[model samples]
Target: MFSGAQISLYPMADDFVSVIMAALTGLDPWREALRIETDDISTLLVGPPEVLFAAMRDLFVRAAQTGVHCVLSAAVSRGCPGEPDDPICMAQGGFARDLALPDRIAAARANVGLAAVTGQDVAAQFSLYPLGEGPHMDEIYGCIDFLKASGTFDRSKNFCTRLRGDAGPVFATLCEAFTNFGTVAGHVVLDVTVSANSPSAR
Candidate 1:
């Protein structure tokens, strides 16, 4: 399977460059585990779900810690038919496609409950797309049920779901949403945006 994310970070401050550069150091721990490439537009991180989400969380938290409003936009995907399989994308444990919907929801919830607390409050909105066929709506509804019980769930919007809470569970919830709803070996994508320290919240 090939899993990766194209992410862009935006910091609302005059010294955005400094904030971005400092926040990037958070990826150092995950560099060895992921194939990382950065350019003017966005950074591409190719790796397993665990390392991928954690690295993103750390980076975003670091930026938010500076008390500057920060937003992280990510297009996360796994098992894309067009992408070749990569060894770095191998994950240790994951739900099987054959698992029942209820089982998957339970597992996803349990995983989110285990997420560490980062103490950084954030709000996020995202849409999960389980590509290909086979009960797509069912999978989407099941994911929605999980989100409602995820503790971080804020509300349901027109085209996406909103989540708000500490960065840890919020990001963990995003990871589970990306990994659990779709077919294990099928194409799945998540369009996510996370924000912290936004003036609008005040």
Candidate 2:
């Protein structure tokens, strides 16, 4: 599968540079796992869905911990049928990617020590889209079912869910959804917008 994300971070503070630096520095550990390129506008991360989302979780959480009111905008896509994957994406196939998800989540949990003024909760909205010629709606429902059953869902919110404690497990669930949908139904894409320490903060 060909997966990539174009992400831009907005740190709401006077010293935005430091906040951004902290977040980018956090990603250094995942550099070996992902292919990252940062330009003026946004950073492009290309790799498997699991690694890409996991890295995003780690990077965004670290940035938000600066207490600078950070908002991350990411357009993530995967499982493009005929699209040619970058070298980094192709290079990820040798190892067992499934086993790595749990390890990544554990690593993320150990790193998060920042206390939030409101509380340490992560919320996200996801729209899973299944492509290609098949029963896409069924696959989409299956993924959503998995998400809801995981006990992390806030069904009251429209197109959104909240993870009250560790962001790692929430991300792990998302990665599972992406992996399952794509592997079973073929081409799939997930449109996600995640926020940590959101403005509402209730």
Root-mean-square deviation per candidate:
0.9, 6.1
Error of 1 at 156 (Å): 0.2
List TM-score per model, in order.
Answer: 0.98, 0.76
**What's the distance in Å from true for residue 39, model 1?**
1.1
Q: How well does candidate 2 score on lDDT at residue 66?
A: 73
What are the per-residue Cα lDDT tens digits for candidate 2 across 89-183?
A: 65342222233334433332332332122233566666667677876766556555556555456663465444444566666566655665534
**For residues 63-174, could you state the per-residue lDDT of candidate 1 as single tens digits?**
9999999999999999888999999999865654568889989988998999999989999999999999767899999999999999899999999999999999999999
CA lDDT, every model vs. true structure: 0.93, 0.64
Which window of 10 residues has the lowest lDDT sum in candidate 2?
A: 110-119
Residue 20 Cα positional deviation in candidate 2, in Å, after optimal superposition: 1.0
Screening candidate 1 with a backbone cut-off below 3 angstroms (N, C-alpha, C), the clashing residue pairs are none
